[model samples]
Structure formats: structure tokens, C-alpha cells
Target: MQGNSEVLVIDDHMKRKQQVELLLQFIGEPCKLVSSANIGEVLTEQVAWRAVVVGQVDIGSPFELVSQLAGQYKAQPFLLIGELGDCVADLPNVIGSVLEPFSHSQMTQMLHRCQDYHLKAPSKTKPTSQHQEILFRSLIGRSGGIQQVRQLIEQVAVTEANVLVLGDSGTGKEVVARNIHYMSARRSGPFVPVNCGAIPPDLLESELFGHEKGAFTGAISARKGRFEMAQGGTLFLDEIGDMPLNMQVKLLRVLQERCFERVGGSTSIDADVRIVAATHRNLEGMIDKGDFREDLFYRLNVFPIEMPSLSERREDVPLLMQELIERLASDHKVTIRLTERALDSLMEHTWPGNVRELANLVERLVILFPNGLIDVNDLPSKYRHVDAPEYDHEYDESLLEQDMLNDVFQNDVYEPPESSMSTQLPPEGLNLKEMMTELEIDMINQALETTDWVVSRAADLLGMRRTTLVEKMRKYSLSKDSA
Candidate 1:
């Protein structure tokens, strides 16, 4: 609690300031970096704030500072930047070391570890997701529907309830399941996901419960199924409604008896894994049509969470787009900026594919444009709901480059606008400070608008300290929602 920074560099003489910025650039993670500044707010702010508070033993209270903030934000890790000492050896938060010269390898290692340690558990759970597809660990939305989904995830995560997430395809059912797994006590264990629909019916049984050698035509070697692999962790069964009725009965038996035998093997293996199933289809309807087992439906529906589609929470589009863009930027090192009209058009569209469609669209645009500024006309034909001007073939990149310069200093930034006014003063002299203040406020507002009022991003755009931006916002009474 003494003096803390987001990446606090304690009273350092060994190149503390410049090194932290370089380290972050190498890692390619977007985070606010501060050097030897205030740490008071960082400790009390959101638990997701990530950075290494570099402290030296001989410096003014770096150890005490890290020690205090360590417990509160365990997920927010640290990289001690100094000579190796036994004093910080036991601190659970000090995950890496930075020598006097600031090694890039050490910084990257810390980030990779932190990604595995992403908000507790973000390790890719096999075929469920790509290894590099590290996404927003926390759901990015402030809408009522998203809030309810988050509440359901939190409530069921700690308990041993079998969760059934029901929603249309691409409504983030897998995202919900992953969150539940990460938040549970079995976080340290594997998260194995099996898509019941994707697998052939003939192989569904083998996929879920494993098979002994020569059990089937292709079973030349013994193989462990999802259930065995997910021992001591969560097993996610996606597209449960699409599962064959015959397979459903077997799944129900395993759920009920909590044990199963591998194919062509008599000995039973304890099904110690937790069950978290999801489906875009309605099981009740399937049961009525005699395509699903009533018993299986009841078994998996112990604690059901209904995910809201993207159309239900249109207010969250900006935030979601921001996160998707950030993820794309981090993963592919390319970015596309959407004009206000284009963003408005997107929010108005009824997203049948839900968040998945939006993600794909963003990625596509980034791929096609890279660092281009996208107007409404620049979007796909189907996405253009509003009347936009004809796409100009000869596009100017200066405006976008300027905006990028405003943002991405730490992330977003605002450039002082070039004055159209002359050097000669009018007969009635003006207050230069007041005029400059007005210009600053106008640019800050523009920056906020550009980033959808993401304060950290806006601060980055303005090329100023986040703390400074907050003070300016306070001084001018600027509010994102109100503005």
C-alpha cells in the first residue's frame, strides 16, 4: 500500500522506467504501464488489472508494496527486476525475474505463464478451442442478460452441480462452460470438451468412454476417451441434443451410476469428472418427438443456464467488438478500425450467428484491411443496414494513423490538433490557457468516443497517464455514458 504502480518500479537506479515499456512491447499484451508512481488505486481496483510491480530489496518498500497487493490480486502476477535474493524467493506472486538489462525472454515467459494462469484457468481444453485462441477470460458485457449468465456461472461453479447450458449456436455456450470449469475447484485439472454432434454415431461411445485394443475396427491401440481424460476436472459435452438416443441412454447411465467400463473391457473406471453439457437444440422438444431420453434431460439439467443471443443484448456490441479487436491484434498483429456509422450499422443488424458471427466478421475485416479504417460501405454487403456513402477507392490512411497514434502510446492517444488560428492576436486578447484547455477537452472527448469510453484505451489515445485522464475527466465533469 506504500507507493504502488500498475507495473510499479520501486525506487530504482538500475534502468527501471524504460525497461518496463520495452518488456511489455515484447510480450504483445496491451496493459497500462507506470513507473515509480501511485500504487494505491491499483490494489483496490478490479482484480483483472495485470502488471508486474518491480521492487528491489534495498529500494523504498517494494517488497512491502508487493507483499500487500499480492494476496488481493494473485492472478495479477509480478516480475521482480533486480539481483536474485532469497527474500522474494517465497513470495507466491513473484513469478519471474528481470535482470539489470531487462531480458525480453524473461518477460515473455512470465506472460506465457500468466496466460496459462489466465484468470485462474484458460489452458486450452483440447479440440474445444485453438491453443492460441486466448480470449477475454471475463465475458465482455454490461447488459442484463450477460450479467445473469455471469451470475449463473458464479453460482454453479463452486458447487458440484451438472450444468446444462442451453442457447442457440454461437451464443457462447462453450465460453460459459469454460468459465464454470476455470472457476471450479478442479481448475488445476484438464478441461476436456467433446462435441457430440461432430463425432459419428458409431464412434460417439468410443469418444466418451474410451476403448480397449481391438474393441472396434480401428481400435488397434487402447485410447482414453473424454471422460478418462477429464478425471478430476470438468467434461464438457457440447450439442447434447444432437446426441443419438442410444448414446443418450449410455450417458445417462454414467451420470446416474457415476462409473463406466471401457469398450471390450469388463473392469469399470470411476467417472470422477464433473459434467457440463450444452446444446443449441431444445431437449424437451426432442424428448416429445422421441429423439431424446427424458431421463437424460433431467440428469443434465440439474442447474440449467440459458444464454441470451447477441440480439438480446445489442448494447454490448461495442464492448464485445473492442475485446475481439484486441484479441485479434494480440494474436495476429493486425487491426481494423470501424467508423461510427459502421459500428452503428452493426449494432442494428440481427446477428443470427450471434457473437461468433461478429468475431468472424471482425477477423475477416482485419484480414482484408489490416490497418485500414472501415466505413459502413467497407463492411460486408449484408452488414450494411444504414445508408453509407460510396466507398472511396483512393482512401486516406492519415486519419486512421493519427487515431492509432492517439491510442497505442500505452494503447490509444490524442494528438494536439494543428491550430487554424494565426499567430497575430486579435484586438480583443483571448485567454490562451482557456483556449488550450477547451481544445484539450474536445480532443479527450473525441478519444473517448473513438474507444467507446474505455478509459484505459482513451488514456492511451491521449498519450497521457490514465490517472491524468481521470483527473481531467473529473475536472471537466466528462462522463462516457452521459457524453
Candidate 2:
């Protein structure tokens, strides 16, 4: 084990040196090891004692003598011996000393200290109050919550297990997904995302597993799904809980087998993709109700990482706001600032929508206050008047208040035409029924616009929850297809 220098092992019993060397290597250390049978060898290799381990030097001279030798080297080396009584009194202050018959824990701790002695510079991002966003350009938080997330990201980046991200919509699940991909060993490869809930059940199969030409009426040519596209990279599944039960079974098989085949293709294809799935639903409850697959749950549950809600980490609000301000200013080519009062107003509100909602608010404020800084007055009337958005729909309030009623109870369901309405409303007026339909459409459109066309966000803006929004979308036959 000897190489360049000597780690003076002072003991008549040569077996002790072997014990120490074994301990050092077990702890992932690469050090030149040496053994000396006598004090004469200690003096010969005393210069090398700059990094020394004196074992059982407790019998003859006072402990101060070994201490003096350590002091001469400007490295007060410690002594590890079979018994304390073996040493003459007056041992100098050694880094650490322990009696022999030491437990594995005690030995390991000593080895760690030795490794710390040879410290090197850390080659990673530093801990700072201002955390970076997914782009690594924009800052995220000036508060404690975001900082904690950053810390967790650092801790988990090097692992090769699947990550399950749990957070409400618009809380930057995709942003977290990107960060994980970038931080992992596969950073150089692509990051492909599949919104499981957004796509139709029939198409979602092809969207994830690819499709051969002639597989379906619309399949004019062969196309790769998200898994194939993200080969040797990362495949992020957004809203994974929304996937059909059958698809979940197939997904579980792919995860277990790491292989799949395109629709209408006989040959199997390898899916060498790291998976990161996100969902807002209570998956455990879903699993209990037989809505989600148990095997798939276990497979994806390898590494469950629950993202902290925005309200839980309020300290980062200011930093996130500033970053949003700068980003919006750059994106739309407008300079905007937040007044102290406006900033205070932001801090005072509970962020149910999390970072995404805040970013939208900032963008809105920037657009609304182009001439100057935004004050409390510039904030939306909803935030000013109440924490929750006002529900102005024509549904019966009494029905909504009923204990047995569902989250959203639909009255008269209407499906829009295949051709979506224009981004601009129609100029031609219609009869009462058509007008009511048009007004409802207008409200949905406004919600989408105000929330930046994010369906879940639009739902929040419309004073309904995300699940309700999806249901309403089905009833009205609306889709992002128009966008």
C-alpha cells in the first residue's frame, strides 16, 4: 500500500498498522500508508509524520515527546493506543485520541476527520439567498421555501432513481423536472414532457408509445412518441394520474422492462429514458379507489419527492417577484417595478396558486403599469377585495352551498362546434340562448387569457378548481387545439 510518503505507524505489534490502513480505504481515501516497528523508524519517517497515525505509543517516554515531534512538524498528530494508562502523563492537545477496542463508529469518525484534514474546494453551486429558476438565468426566491427546494435539488441530483413530483398546478412542476434532468448524469441529452391529462385517451397511447404509418386514420407517417424521443435523456410525465388505467399498466410494464414498441410495430424498442412524473391529485387515495394501478404506483414510487406549496415557503416571495419582474420586462420589452406597498400587499396574501400564479400577477402588473412602479392599487381587484376569486357564474348559489352537491354541478351542457371561436369574440349578436352561450364562452376565454392559457390556471381565475375546469371543458367541447 506504500507509495510516496509515510504514515508512521508506531507499534511493536505490526498487525495494528494493517488495521488502520484498512479503515482508511474503507472510507474512500487514497493515502500513502506506512508501518514502523520501532521509535527508530518513527524518527526516520518522522518528517513524513506530517500525515501520521501513531498506534500504541503508550509505554516508554512521556506522551509529550510524541506531542513535541508532532509540534516540530507543525502537525500535532494524534495517538491511538490500546490503553490510556500506557502513556506517561502530559499528552499535548491532539486533534482526537481514542483508546483501543474502539467501536466501528469511533474508527469511522476518526477516518472522516483525517479525510477532512485533506479538504478540497467544492465544485458546485453555492448556497445563496437568491435561488435560480429552471433556466438558471432567472432567480426564483428571496425567501426560505425556495432556498430549501434548491438545497433538496442539490442533494438528490446525483441519484438514478425515478422522481415523483407532487404539487398543485402552475407550481412549476415542469421547471423542477428540467432542473432534475440538468443536474443528473444525463444533462447533455434532451428533456421531453408529456401532459398525460391534456391529450385524449386514444391519442395518448400513440403520444407515449409512438405510432407506425397506417396504425390509425390520421397516421399518414411513422412518428416517435415521448419515450422514443427522449431516448438516452429524460421523459417527464405531467399530470400522470390522469392517465387511463390500461395505459398505467403498460407504463408500469415499460418501467419494469425498460422496453416498448410503437403501435402496429412488431419489434420491441428499448426506452432508455429517465422518468420524472408529476401530478396534483392525491395518488394514494386514487390507488385506494382502484383508479390508479398498484404495480405502477410502486414502480414510480421509487423516489417520491413532494414539492413544497408556495404558502408553506412564503419567505421566497420577494425573490420570486423580482425575478418575475425582470423576466416579464425582458420578454415584453417593458420596464416595471413594484412599489413597497405593492410588494407588501403581495407578501400579505396567501399564495394558493404558488410561484406560477405570482409570475402571472407580475406579468399582469407589468403590462398594466408600464409608465411607472406598481402600487397596491395596481393589483387585481380579486386580491384586493378577497383572497379567493369571485364566482360570477349564473349557477344557483343555493345548489353550490348544498352539502351533498358536487364541486361543480352542471345545469345545461352545450358542446362548441369543431371550429373554435376566434380569439376575438363575434361581432354579430344572437338570440337569448346563443347570447348566453356566447357570454359563457367569453368568460372562459377571459379566464384563459388572464391565466396565460394554462387550463388549470384558467380554472383558478374562473373561480373554479382545476378538476372542475376539465369537466366543464368536456361539457363545452373546448380544447387547447384552438391555441
- Candidate RMSDs in order: 10.9, 27.0
Instruction: Tell me the tens digit of each residue's lDDT in model 1 across 1-483.
Output: 121212434434444454466455433334454445555544453434344546544546665656666665555566666653566667665666666444433454455454444434333311122222234532556566887887777778889999999998988999989988876788778999999999999999999999999997988999998999999999999999889888988998999999999898888999989999999987888889999999888999999999999998775675577668767777888876776457667877899999999989988999889977788888889998877687674766545423322322343243444685566778999998798789888889999999998766787787674535754776798886669
Question: Which tens-of-lDDT digit does each residue in 367-428 have in candidate 2?
Answer: 67784555556678655522333333354433322211134222435545557644455588
Give all TM-scores, in the order shown.
0.60, 0.52
Model 1 spans with C-alpha error above 4 angstroms: 1-138, 390-483
lDDT score of residue 220 within candidate 1: 96
Best candidate, TM-score? 1
lDDT of 1 at 258: 95
The ten-residue window of minimal lDDT in model 2 covers 125-134
Best-fitting candidate, scored by lDDT = 1
